[model samples]
Target: MSATDKKQKQAVIAGAGPAGLTGAYELLKHTDIHPVVFEESGEIGGISRTVRYHGNRMDIGGHRFFSKSQRVTDWWDEIMPLQGAPSLDDKLLHTTDKTFAANGPDPEQCDRVMLVRNRISRIFYLHKFFDYPISLKWQTFANMGLVRTIEAGCGYLWSVFFKKPETSLENFYINRFGKPLYRMFFEDYTEKVWGVHPSKLGADWGAQRVKGLSIFAILKDMLKKSFSKKENIKEVETSLIEQFVYPKLGPGQLWETVADEVRQRGGEVITETPVKEIHVENNRVTSVTVENAQGERREVPCDYLLSSLPLKDLVQSIRGIEVPDEVKRIAGDLPYRDFITVGLLMKRLTIDNQTRIKTFANRIPDTWIYIQERDVRIGRLQVFNNWSPYLVKNYENTVWIGLEYFCTEGDAFWQMDDRAFIDMAVGELAKIGIIDPADVLDSVRIKVKKAYPSYFGSYYELDRVKEFLNGIENLWCIGRNGQHRYNNMDHSMMTAMVAVDHIAAGNTDKSAVWSVNTEEEYHESK
Candidate 1:
């Protein structure tokens, strides 16, 4: 077959991120639609790539997804499988920080699940979820008699009764979590993560994420635990909380596997090939033009195309794709706060136990201690050793302590030299007594320019943009950047699957792809 014939037969994929790679893997396995993945970065994993830092392994912003789908879990096993994964029990010891003892579960690790008591043994708590699943028992118990709990209750009542019509996150959170929790637990870490006030974020995202758990739920959990009432079947947070999984190495392993499988299935995954222009013809996506590292350009075409590139980008290069200038203006207008992860490879197996911080510290989110009080750039402290011990080196045990910093794309922190960033992290860790700077074996930094999609209550405009793009034929987009959605890894990969199924079935549907972060069974537009 000629080169063009071969290219045409193979489905051309844009971006080697998880979504793109997942689509390529399933498509190749289920159909003859050989998929060729094109990634802008030289590396395979997108936001989830694993970095070997100072002889230690680390991930970005502790980006592993613990609460997720069985389908995604099964697919991961098919590719990278958790060969060296430590048992769930072993994982517990790692996550227990002093903050956990002083406060509660970190929002990052709060994948609430039922506590299966070991009748097989002496009924020692199988997993460390307080009151198991909802954690209502633990949350209320920890904050008992504290004014903050009453304030949070008032926040909820204020939200429910006053019913703030405001849609921005700042208003939503203030209404629900009260100013104390919002300022203490959310403010600085949020400002560092998103470079915006929690108040400025859209409430819709908050609604979708932490909507189910309420003061009422907490009270119920407390009563149940007190009476030792046996629930026939423990109903965990069915809305979003449940048992979750992660890659043994790190979340990055999943995307890396998909990229590997794409090539193994006779398709191609070309990394570092940035698409300069997405060529279009007669309202259909004809091909994508890419540039190699040497500043050379090449064009590849396909009858079908799946894009995980940003929507504003796709619409800008294509004609007859009626993305209104106003709409495009709004879409382009969407902004994101960049994130930098300062991964510290310390000599110890865990952080110091003397910290008075709580797991989800009111001010610092005791889970990831937010050093907001200090003028330092370190935003949140992630005890990576708590996430998984396998990422560390040596049988003696190691600690992967991370600090999350926020910045604009080209700002000081984002542009800060790697060595300097590492130094800054070690300094901050020492100041907080979380780590001994001398004990820091080494550190590394990974900067994510588009780590989060900032919601400015302009989601209506984004929705309009989606509606416009949905009208097009034979072209699809999915993923965090792909859909401009604030999605965790699981939701993003699921978007890729929906897009793939659409093209494979020769049908047209777009809703299913964006229908994630909600407990809904989505289907391709037919």
Candidate 2:
């Protein structure tokens, strides 16, 4: 066929989040395929979306833009270049260790820029702060009393000598950090986050999220830093990364920029429109039915379908396909954890700045604080000021913080009224002595469904579902919810990039897309 006579191919993408946006951008950049993206909500980013309320912005679950993949970092730089000049807080405080491009955009003057931020995350347990990975320091030992310290040491030695089979997450933790440390640090907080005991959860959860993070790794890192120059030390674990890059406004700003670029490049990005049905013919996706907010539905034809929707929803939306009964049961029973982030704009924090790190108003320098106290239901606390001064509207005067809570949808906590939920969050912070309830100025609550894909509940049998879906030659699943795995932001992008690579090369085997974060050595070496 002549070039002029050839048909123009169309690619339909569901969910305008990282994976969908990345797929559309890659298709436009590399292939001749025209792309159209549909998002259920009006917002651009999914969980990574920013919520702006009363001049203050909230980053839903605290996205730290750090990746081990060079391609991911380069992609970010291409979208929003890093700042050359210091940001507002950095300039005011004269911070010296931050990395800045020589001639990049100035964040103070430019709205579209990325800021280099310090990573300071810790654990709050027993009314004291400890290093997140259970650092070996005098203060840490002090916080954990002498008796507890000795017990932890003995338990560690015992674990080293007698390793248990890693069948459950509880066993994984006990084998790595010993039972004493795991009980003291990880047990309660993990249960709070997943609403299940560690003994019942699969070990894959630990392998993926907390890979190679253990007492031995912590000691090796400390020794390496002690001997080698800070700049010379490389290959640190992801959990031990000290610095990361973040968008000036928030993560959503980057996605919004990408969406605009897609539109400018002749690609269509329609918001408030959700892909409701998938029409398959001869084991291939040929069209998708979408519904707008006005209750209008239309079937659009496409040559390729890239889906970033939840696995359950995706399986249920398929038409003209004989899905196996086992696959249907597994997809229907796939479990997910919901999230709630309570943004509290306070005059000041009651907690003191115990660290040496300098800040705008001598506030605690923590991007995230894992709440390990069993008394309160808050899983984590995020200080927006530390994430980026631009995130908080009144950076110098007011403290913008987010309190995270994990629960299942339609539960009592999820059904609570906004005011009551905010009140409960504030009271929890007060109860934990992290804040004084009276100092709270204003509050906003945001809820996200299927925020985290759980490893339990029919998840072990997900391979059958994947095999069934892979039979559709024109369909590709790429993202956290798409794969039903707890992937980081970069992993999700990598999956989409891999799928686009396959599409461009006419390679239909979907194994590469599924193997993004599953390799043991790939995650360990990074």
For each candidate in turn, the TM-score is 0.78, 0.96
lDDT of 1 at 369: 41
The parts of candidate 2 lying over 4 Å away from their true place are 93-109, 231-234, 521-526
Highest-TM-score candidate? 2
Measured with C-alpha atoms, the lDDT of residue 121 in candidate 2 is: 90
lDDT of 2: 0.89
lDDT of 2 at 42: 95
Task: Indicate which candidate wins on lDDT.
Answer: 2
Superposing all C-alpha atoms, what RMSD in Å does each candidate have to the true structure? 8.2, 3.4
Query: What lDDT does each candidate get?
Result: 0.61, 0.89
Candidate 1 lDDT, 103-196, residue by residue in tens: 4223234222212111100000111112222234344335334675677556556666665655677666666555555654456655666666
